[model samples]
Target: MTPVSSPYVPDVSRYTKRESRAVPVGPIQIGGGAPIVIQSMLTSDTMDTGACVREALDLVEAGCELVRITAPTVKDAANLRAIRDELRSRGCPVPLVADIHFKPEAAMEAARWVDKIRINPGNYADRKKFVVRSYTDEEYASAVARLEDAFLPLVHLCQERGIAMRIGTNHGSLSDRILNRYGDTPLGMVESALEYARICRKAGFHRIVFSMKASNPRIMISAYRRLIAVLQELGPDWNYPIHLGVTEAGDGEDGRVKSAVGIGALLADGIGDTIRVSLTEDSVREIPVAEALRALVEEFAGAPRPKEALVPPFDPFSFQRRHSHRWVRNAKVGGGEPVRVAVLEENFAALESASAGTEMVPELGYRPGMAEEVDPEDPATLAELETGAPRLVTVRDGCPYPPLYAFRMLAARIPSRHPILLKDTFFPGEKGDPLRERLNSALQVGALLCDGIGDAVLLRREADPKKALELSYNILQATGNRSFKADFVACPSCGRTLFNLQETTARIRAATGHLKGVKIAVMGCIVNGPGEMADADFGYVGGAPGKVNLYVGKKAVRFNIPQEQAVDSLIALIAEEGKWIDPPRS
Candidate 1:
């Protein structure tokens, strides 16, 4: 099988969940045709059993079916027993998962306590020293054998205990071997997880799930799609429950949108069994967002799927912007320019005063007859692009399919020469529910953006034009298609976190949000900090309880800056790197 099977056909449609093996995590089921499960990680320290128990209970109470706690060390793994006993003694049967990294002994200890053990293949066997070297086939095989030896103990322990395992691969943490071979691409992430899975398959352990997580939605989406393709190629017995997440997704609206874009996009494509929305907020806060995303999936799960032969509209496993013609000749609507944003011309003036010198300005205005209209649902409209001269084309209003699927069809049918004007969400542009608007924009448009579609986005129906403009930019930034200001990808606090993630992320944003095109990562600890924040130009990671580490990309240049001086030092690093810019005059 290839990254994208030419004329690939999935058994399910964009509106259904793909059938997968149901791995039992305690009393709950993850795939094998089960409802999409919602999960979150506890931010409380593992040694603080009371705090862990309280947070786990809060998450379960808020409808989290599964809870994960980080056990970075053997001692932390041992504390899981206390946390579990306390939770179970209090009548809480919510399934617990041990999040393990860089320690096989810790995973073995954790397997004895939790219902499921999630091992990051990137770090479970190999420490990431960012070593870049070539390895011959013999050396690679030896490394794989060593990895198998280290991982099999935990696999056997999980199987013997009749528990489940999650082979969760993080994009930023691929081992030196995989990185040298695949260069941090989605294919590498899938292979990293598969190496461990193949060993489990050999050991006759079928109770397993898999996840390919990255802070970037494009990578996360592509990696999971590639995983599904490989699993299908491996045959029926290899079907495993898949876990989904966009790690280091920051706080509040922006974070939620980032999560929705990645998770909602795949869920809409009939992928993913369990999901976690990692936000830099309270652990319990993540539950509602995950539930909301799951609800969006189930809402369309029953819709009739298309029966025609399905060819992926674009390359499913790559990040190349589709080759759109320079049809909007007068403007930067196509020809590989950054995805443009447009708002209704009438609504733009209303926000004109507020939009000045900020992110509120839209790149183009949606006047009545600015472009040729192409109804995404109509097969005949697709032919119009070829019949006439190449020009800017937008989806006509009232397409029956959801925007995610509809836009995909448009992308599949339209000529490469015709530039697309994405008209997201077919709702009224009136003051109503803001959450609805945000979700629709994120789920519909944000999803497509990550898929390398949509040359320009027009939020025509959003009542608030300023919000429409901001949402458009947020979607673009979240997908790594464009950046209007400093972009943040922060992990939700976990037991492994050494400092206050929520407070620190907010402070970092306040200090540096003005620097356009600069990306900073605010991480709680090293577990996912160095790897997950690989895309950030500068990194602010929690080094210890009261110390912070600053990084330039994956390289940590500063060991431990005092917590109070960390932000200042980070700013200085930015200045030293020549990325610091003065905030605009008010």
Candidate 2:
């Protein structure tokens, strides 16, 4: 596959900051070289003015720069005026964004109230029926014409109301028209938004932001890169700010790892203007993750750009692990081996016991008596260790140097053949949770893994060791290094969902928790399920009320099964395909 090139010319800078025209949203600015903005959405019902105001205020207090509320109907859109009034009365005048799907009238009403309006291009004017049909040239043109007729009114309303607009394209939610035309790829995600962009430009509306989001980090990163290339081709005047996110990133460590891998990878390339870390947890909990990611971009923002390293051998557009010699026989890593996992424990007995039956490599701090383990921070000790010993080198957190720079320095000095373990520890100062710490660790360690630098990862915190181990593999999974458990890709429930997404996702995960090396996507609806779950081994999607659709790869093999029996049916399908293995006797 051809490597995707950066949109900007090659430079010494780590990221080629995509220059964009700053669009004003309320008192703050996005793009145009503004500091990367941090934003979050309120999960409270929009019609409940009190609850919406309280949540909006809470998010703003937690350092959220912008707040988004769902406006599913004309009434909900109109209710935003009341919510804004209550917030202003409370002396919290933060900018409000109305999230609209499939309702132009709601969008129009929202444009009149909120500081910005976000419309999903996949469902803004088109309904997703999961139908596959061919459209002739004239028919396609007519459809575009109808889309413009439906969307132009909102464009004009936003322009007149001085409200900015975000054309957010979700990987799982592309219109059937776009999917049929573009085959549900990154190109389709970009084209879906660009189609709306074309209409906006024709209507002379320029205060726009664009986002290409996906549950998969690779897809999200690739789509954003391709979108920038397409925008650059359109001309310099079309440089709209990008809002970065990984939608439906499930809760806790898994969510953080997934969000960081997708958002951090793009931000490292200097691609995002504003960011939202969409966790399945409380909306307020999302602020710290966003702040941590922003801190990463800021750390490099003003520093002198380092000289570009040797052109990497791997493709930038796609993921392919970098080649390195497989030096350690006991703990195999690099040279196309499955990425290893390492656990950092001060206790020798615990470390020894943990490594006995598993592939986990044990890492310890420097001490004279412990000859069996490797000291991750000290190069001299590592050099003295007997050749071929089961050594796992560590690059610790809170180093004097930047973490990635520290890793590079260690990599340069150590033998390239040795299996190195990357470690990150977060003590979320007061007022922070373990979730925030997990996100920080993921961002710190994940950055190196994305460049194919580490063999294994060790995420440490004051929390449970098991949680840390889980986080280690999650980071590996997010970076596409390894998968120790079934990968669950589910969307966070939205107004368009026909069923209870969170509850259903939990049911699916509970039933399949023991299946290793499998990928299952539990999607709330068909809007983007068939396409977004394209990489999944099997998919359980909401087809209709109390009905589920099952997929093997992208092909929907079973349609409209009762929701209550969906999990059993999915397992039966997996067993039929000979991919299911019974759990070991406990």
Candidate 3:
């Protein structure tokens, strides 16, 4: 099959930064060297006008530049008008975005009331039944024609109303046609959004943004990079501002770390214009995290230019683990070993106490016989290392050099066979919270891992060792280095979800949470479940009312099992496949 052509390029080195055309959304301007914008979504029912307005106001006050609300139907889309009117009346005139899925009419109606409209091309005019079929040239052309017929009105309407559109494509939600042709990969994601973008361009609708979202950071980062490459090939004028996000990132540390890895990886390459940290927690809490990520990206982007042109050691557009030699036999630090997690404490006692019950290595800056820790300012000290253990290099915030460049300089001075432990410290002080701290660490530390620079990561902050350990593993997981716990890839509940996603996810997690290295996806619907859970070891997806489907790596093994017995059935399937390990005796 011929590869699809994209309008953007993946060559980050070609441009000092990704220079995009400024797309105006209400009073806000995105891209074209503008400050990266922060965005969040409202979880309240759209029909509940007061609730929606209240959430929107809260989001704006929390530093959200753009607020999005779901519009699953025409009634919900119409309700946005009331929400917008109330917000405007109340002095909160933040740009509102209508999130549309499988509803073109809703998109048209939403275009009139909102500053921007976001539509999922996988389902806007196409139904995803996981059907697989080959389309002839005529059939494919007919499908495109039909899609244009359904989508053009909204395109024309948005253009006339000066409303920007985001052709956001979800990894799990690609149309059957796209999957049949592209096999549900990142290429499929780029093609899905490009189809709608081509339509928008033909209609002279240039005010558009594109996003390629996924639950998996690897897939998400790969898709966005591929989209850029395709877009660069399309034309200079086709450089649309890209929106960055990781869909269904679970709450707490996991969510923050995942969002940071996917969004931060692209941002490090200067690829994102607007970003939303999609956490399962209240949308208001997402703002600070997004703020921290943006700040970190800006810090790196504004770093002093290297004295000489430095090419990246690894491909920025693709995912490849850095090659290294293993350090220890039992605790492998590098050389195809899982990225290790270490705890950096103020003292040896504190490090030992914090890492007592875990496999996490403990390192102290001042302890003798411990791993060598060097400050970025003093590189000559690296030559004095007498111990053969991997060195623990601390790259604290407020360093004179950009973290990336500093790492490169350190690598140049050190021996190639010596594995290095990257420890990133953040002192948020009065300007940060737990969420901000988490995001900052992920961006700084996770960015290095994505670039294949670190073999182990130790995040140091003024928090307990347990929390730090959890965060270190999360960073490793997000960077696709390790999997500590059962990877729960659950979607944030939306209008299309048929069952109680949160409750079901909780139950599934309770039963299988102990299965380390096992990936189980709990999806709310079939729209993107099978395809989205492509990386999962097992899947529990909603099939119909009061029914569920069980999948083993994207292939359905059982159909329509009663929801009550679904969990047990899933466990049984896992055991039958020899992946089940019983919980230890309490």
Candidate 4:
């Protein structure tokens, strides 16, 4: 499939949910300007009808609008009937979804019992051996015909039964055809899903949602933006609601930051209709995080004041770090250096006392007042920029636009070679509510970092510098801008998980947490493990109930290692690859 080019970047000047065809999932509607829906998948076994019912009730009780359960087999798909029946009897009328992969028969069976069916287009009808091959035009057309035959049956079943579908594409699971055609790119991810979507569209089935999920926050954000642009080019009727998530976003604050940066960045501009904060922890715990992210972008409902029209100078569908010449002797804040941390000299005096145990030292301690002030609302400031000597610049305070857009406006007008000091608080010396400050900083500043706009970041008026430093570094790591510690990509636990994901992830972190720059993926199952951690250097994935499969960049080197011995083997594998180091004695 070829990508259609369109000048359809989200307007950063204000926040408004993107309009889409309303997709009815049971009693609730997604998109068409409906309230952003929150959903999560069940982690309990589908065969355990009692467990499944209990889990569904818990999610519904926690305010989850939709619940998804994995149906990897026909038997598992059939059991959804019992699960649905039990939930209805218990007065829980929440919608149910069947998560299907590589199984059309199971998807068809699942369509009969659930309100929605989510099929990975990579596996719906196409084969993926990760082989290097090319498809001739006729062969490619034949493949599309095959996909049509396999997918339209379920589309017809769904249309007839008043069911919805999500053509959810995973970065790690593209078909050989798509991979050979588009490589492993954001375009590839979009095309993979659009092929199936076109099949549905031709059959007059439009009750569909689309998602482009990747573990990398940058990739996840870019793919969603690209997906929207393509949809716009396709026509107005193709306004399908988007499902936003960063798959295998790990757990805890790390997971939250990853989810927020990728999903929140889009949410700031009103791109998602529904969201799932994928975490490696409890599925129920995901709801409140989703709610918080949903609320954070609510201010976008209207402009605080008249704002300038959005005609950004950067590409929204791809990340190209804003070019800047090295301005500092340390070369830490520009000219291809990792984004630096900063504490303005005025704030430094206050933060120095609270910084006893913190390792972070701002690279530039000069007062922010000393930098060139770029007023975002004024185009004259942008045109005045000179690229001769590298200048340190920061957005002027009281700019009508939010940080995400303000910096975007700042970035558009500046000499591309000047380093920018990204600030968390635009107001100087005012200690606002800590929670609000944190959310604004994480969502707004984090979004800019993902856009490759920041060269240095500071939580300008944050009450606690220690906490601010922690949050700043985490955001940088989450956005793939820098890594100060060992990184991980872990999927939220689901019914298909073969082993105890939470406990295993804990164990892996305990042993490998100190390996800075080494990214490890802990997956509960093979379904998404190999492909999901698109960036991890090593992998610990569940091969079976009592077994583990260890990988070195998607290649399984050790299979069925006893669960008890898996960690040791994984460590040995890391050591053999010359990527392991003894943790510093503490």
List, residue by residue over 1-586, the lDDT tens digit for candidate 3: 3454443333322225688999998889888889999999887778988888888888888999998888878998998899999998998879999998877888888888999999998889986877878999899879988998899999999988898889999988889888888887888899899888888889888999999999888778888988888777777898889999998787667788889888987887778999998775677988988888888776666666544444455555566776667776335566677777665435546666755755444532332244444543464676654346555444444555645555655554555555667656523242346666667677767877776777776666536566776677778777777765778887665545667776788888889977888988888777547866767899898898889999999899999999989999999999999999987555
lDDT of 3 at 343: 50
State the local distance difference test value for candidate 2: 0.74
lDDT of 2 by residue, 206-313 (tens): 999999998877778778877887787778898999999997777666777899888986776688999998775677888888888887676545544444342433
Q: Is candidate 1 or candidate 2 better by lDDT?
A: 1
Please give the CA lDDT of all the candidate structures: 0.82, 0.74, 0.76, 0.84
Per-residue CA lDDT of model 1 for 347-436, tens digit only, reads 666666677888646667678678877775567767667766667887677555677776777777788777788877654554544665
Tell me the TM-score of model 1. Answer: 0.95
To one decimal, what is the Cα RMSD in angstroms of model 1 from the true structure? 2.1
Top model by lDDT, which number?
4
* Tens digits of lDDT, candidate 4, 122-165: 88889877788889999989999988998889999999999999
Candidate 2 has its poorest 10 consecutive residues by lDDT at: 366-375
Which pairs of residues collide in model 4?
172-531
State the TM-score for model 4: 0.95
The per-prediction tally of clashing pairs is: 3, 2, 14, 1
Listed in order, each prediction's TM-score against the native is 0.95, 0.79, 0.84, 0.95
- Give the candidate order by descending TM-score: 1, 4, 3, 2
Better of 1 and 4 by lDDT: 4
